[model samples]
Target: LGSVLLLLALYVLQGVPLGLAGSVPLILQSRSASYTEQAFFSLVFWPFSLKLLWAPLVDAVYVRRFGRRKSWLVPTQYVLGLFMIGLSRRVDALLGDGQGRGPDVVALTATFFLFEFLAATQDIAVDGWALTMLSRENVGYASTCNSVGQTAGYFLGNVLFLALESPSFCNKYLRFQPQPRGIVTLSDFLFFWGAVFLITTTLVALLKKENKELTPTKEETKGITDTYKLLFSIIKMPAVLTFCLLILTAKVGFSAADAVTGLKLVEEGVPKEHLALLAVPMVPVQIILPLIISKYTAGPQPLNTFYKAMPFRLLFGLEFAFLVWWTPKVKHEGGFPVYYYVVVLLSYALHQVTLYSMYVAIMAFNAKVSDPLIGGTYMTLLNTVSNLGGNWPSTVALWLVDPLTVKECVGAQEQACGTAAAAELCTKAGGSCVTTLDGYYVESVVCVILGFAWWFLFGPKLKKLQDEGQSSWKCKRTN
Candidate 1:
């Protein structure tokens, strides 16, 4: 339990930076950034998607004295902290004025790129560490850590920041509390989280010690060559191959829509404060569902539990799509009912719970199968594949939806008519204005079809494979 808690803490650190960085797109949107710029901001997470590139190196190299995972973990955390602190100082310069024309987008994104790289590297180490720290029977708990800690971190990093930036928050708090200009941006928030990273580092350094025996065999640690060899061997296994396929397809139905909807809401003029306020109900869901799902899936047939839950989870994407369609009507007609917001908020919370539960289940699955010899590389590969498969559609949406919908315009007409007329002209040029739901309609149909096909075709075979492989993998470990 203590080990799981520690792993959870580390994951929270990982989540915080990502959450903070993830806000860039929304921030850009609020500042009237272009669709291209917003999409580019969203793509800043590419490092996380591609962390497998360096994961092998993390596996191959480690200081024996400090510990296999710890050697990397400790340094990465400190560097992450330092980077956050540095980012805090530069937030003003990077973010520029809140208008769309702020700092150089390229440079700001580069800094974000660097931050995500460190965070991704830390994730590789942490995933490796979880496998070694926990016994085979309890390894599934790593999923709980990933789900809960990451969710909490995202709430803090992304949602909390959004709330703070909202007019309501500013009107309520800033009016009374005159903060310094230095504290205006996410600088103070970044610094605070950086302190959290350092504190976690200290705890691990002082209170916990790694078991020498848990280190990969000296042969496994020879270098990158050996890491690749082990990774290749693992990939060749039938179960691992199936697992890879499962991850690649899993998020297609639900995850993609969830990714695009927030931007849709922002584009629709839903105030960040209202969205954040509504999101407060989700905090408990984030913390609670992981515990429930982790416990349920920790049983012998984890994949079966996941399979059973698929139909229900698949509905969330469509529900979210409906919310996107309905929200604007409610806002415009009745002034945005509190009940309407509550219903949408709760629906999203439930969706997040089930969706992320499945996600956690799979991460637990990866943790279970990964060979400790190349733990970092193997696990990182699985997660990277999952993220890539899932993120591909979302990234596409970031770029694709921009041109599909007309929200702004350019030309000499803007000089007299202003931004609104410019937008109308742009829409006129595009031939018609697209509602927020237009993008989601396409996603919903595709996702629903894919969801059913996966369940009917591939799910049962994968479950059987998972069940059979567990016994064999255990025997191999025992030997």
Candidate 2:
């Protein structure tokens, strides 16, 4: 059990490295004033969403002669570690394309894509392994633990490394170059990515081994197509569709909040060091939230448990509030990093806990939706579609920010008028006593709410456990 947790921890940790690597471009795009440069810069993260396209193959194939979860998992983990190491080695070269605009985005994406493929493959194997390892009594614990691992990695991986790009610090460190404005652009650093690939590859080869399963006989391996068959079955189910939609909608408002706050902090001179320290709370939230969820679901109050997890009404209400009010009132005059950070911290902690409630609800919903025979396939398909949905909105959000020259128009203004309210500065900036990245938040909230409504109204809901359409009964997300 300990080894499984550790291996899974390693596996989940890969996401952060990958997410952080991806975040570099997002940081550059959000902060850099040039729309064209950011557009080119954004190209490096393109492969993240595209990853789900190949998720099926990752499920079906293994490196070992026999087919088992760890066979493929072992190899994939090392590849990701090496990919990060390589990027680290080339950190200087990888960043700061300046206005030159990365001509090498394709190559960079190619390498990032390589890293993502292995990382995704490992994700599949680990998820598969997790199911095999859990008993019904312990499944919630296992899922929650798994969530903890993935979520922990997500926060740590991104925050620890993403802070490296702090403009003030990078501005100083990057002075060595002809146009050293930032540390790494990602697009221009493909050659060095090989190091990450090499390191991650070596780690996997060193650490993992297959524990279960068998080599298929010639007849069993004849079609060698567990992937295609499973995929086909998943699409046939209506429950899978609803589940996927729910996952996509779960944290959109939360995501918008995060995007807005990050911009606000950087604008207010909340140094990365301060931001880094302030961010400590998020780590515990990720670790603890999932466990809270697992424990909540383990009890006997089925509907109550489901409601706490679903909180659909609460989530929607928050979306409306975020869109029309909450974010628009951001105050930064006193410059209380403690206050500002606390608001964000509390907001995210609630967000994390509530969101995992949805995950618990999702698992329940999927189980209620389908039986075991097609259940695995159904879940995988839902995960794939939900992941894809995440991309659609995320890309739209990122793309919107890029072209609008958000940091210049918004970031600078935000920096300038954080607490001018009832003071000369506030009157100087014109309208309110204070100004904020509220506009950005408002824009994102509106988009997310609209999307949520569309999905809520037009997207399918659970009527019957297996019902497919309008005839289905109205309901909640139990899993």
Candidate 3:
């Protein structure tokens, strides 16, 4: 019970940084261009994809006296706390709050990129630790802890923060007298979490002792160079290479809906705070679904659950596009009718089901297939491929939004507002850039079509890979 709770705490801390980074897009949607916001997200998330490069080092190089996991975890958390505190002092200025100047996109990217790098390092340590932290029979619970803890932390950082940060939301629900700003500012939140990180790290360092019995013998423990070689050998296997290709391409179909839908809804006039709040109902859902999904994924054919969930998720993309189209119609002078919220909540709930189903299935599959000899490096490699699959496509979708959109300047300047600069010029010239077509819808259609195509081409391969004997994925170590 204590180990589970500790693992949960570490994962929650890991998740908060991700939640904070994810919230930046919502905060900047009104202030920054879509492409710029996407670029920032792309850079911040690069660390997760690239962290696999250092996973072998993280797995192999540690002070035996200090504890392998704690050697990395303790220092990484300390650095993370200090980094957050330093960033809190300058974040407001960097975001251009109350300033006429636009956000410093490059600077924000660099800062958060480092922030995520620290978090990713922490993730590698914790993931490796989880394998040893539990009894073999109970090791499966690590996925549950990860899903629940991370979801809870993300809720606190994104949804709850957004709601509390909105003056209107606070005034409507939580306050007797309205203030000009929400109760918590981003800086205050950052500073508070930074303190939490420091305190938590101190407690863990003082109280928690890693089980030395789990440590491999001197002869069994691979050096950093040997660990990397093992990683490369694992990748060279035909089955493993095929799996990596599948992981890299599987998310292409869901990218537009997953990355752009919420932003598009915000663009279409759903308040960001309200949109954040919409996720509130899913908190419990996110926590519970993983436990339930784990049962199905524990079978020999874990990818079967993932394969079945894919089409439903793809279908939700179209549903989200429809919701974006319908939002304006439901929106009124004051606010949306109650039924609009119901529809959205119901739709989103269904989407969450499919999303979590796929997520848990893939994670379980990763855990099942990972080579125990280099557990951290192997699992991180698979996770990196999966994350890259989602990241690159989302980045591409965001980049293409402006280009695929069709608009015209109507009124004083009657011209095609094909670019953001043209649209800005149109607004300055007393003309409005009227959208003849929304890029989101077009992208959604293209993504769904591509998703189905992928399923047709690669669906059988996924099943076959899952059915392959475990020995096929094992590294063939040569002395």
How many residue pairs clash (N, CA or C atoms closer than 3 angstroms) in each of the candidate models, in the order given? 0, 26, 0
The candidate that achieves the highest lDDT relative to the unseen native structure: 3
Model 1 off-target regions past 4 Å?
A: 1-12, 63-71, 96-104, 126-152, 173-183, 191-222, 277-279, 294-301, 332-335, 360-383, 406-437, 453-479
Residues 270-366 of candidate 2 have per-residue lDDT tens digits of: 4543455455667766567656676655543322443444434345435433533443355456444355556656665666665667556555454
**Global CA lDDT computed for model 2:** 0.50
**What is the per-residue lDDT of model 3 for residues 1-479, given as tens digits with 9 covering 90 to 100?**
89999999999999899889888887777565466466556668788788888877787778989998999999999999999998999998887864557777788888899999999999889988997898788899997888778887887888888888888899899999988999998899999999999999999999999988986566337787887787789889999899989888989999899889888877777778998888877777877888899999999889999989999999998999999999999989988888998999999899989998998898999999998875566787787788888888888888888778888899864655877677788888889988889888899999999999999899889878988888998888898
Query: Judged by lDDT relative to the true structure, which candidate is superior, 1 or 3?
Result: 3
Taken over the whole model, the C-alpha lDDT of each candidate is 0.72, 0.50, 0.86
Winning candidate number (TM-score): 3
* Residue pairs in clash, model 3: none
Q: How far in Å is the alpha carbon of 213 misplaced in model 1? A: 8.3
Superposition TM-score, candidate 1 onto the true structure:
0.76
The TM-score, computed over Cα atoms with residue i paired to residue i, of candidate 3 is 0.91
Task: Show where candidate 2 strays beyond 4 Å.
Answer: 29-56, 62-82, 97-111, 128-145, 162-209, 212-226, 238-255, 258-261, 272-277, 291-336, 402-442, 448-452, 455-479
* TM-score against native, each model: 0.76, 0.64, 0.91
Candidate 3 shows a clash count of 0
What lDDT would candidate 3 get against the real structure?
Answer: 0.86
lDDT of 1 by residue, 301-417 (tens): 677767877888888778877877787777765346788777877788777777767777777776777666543556767777878877766666556654555332333333222
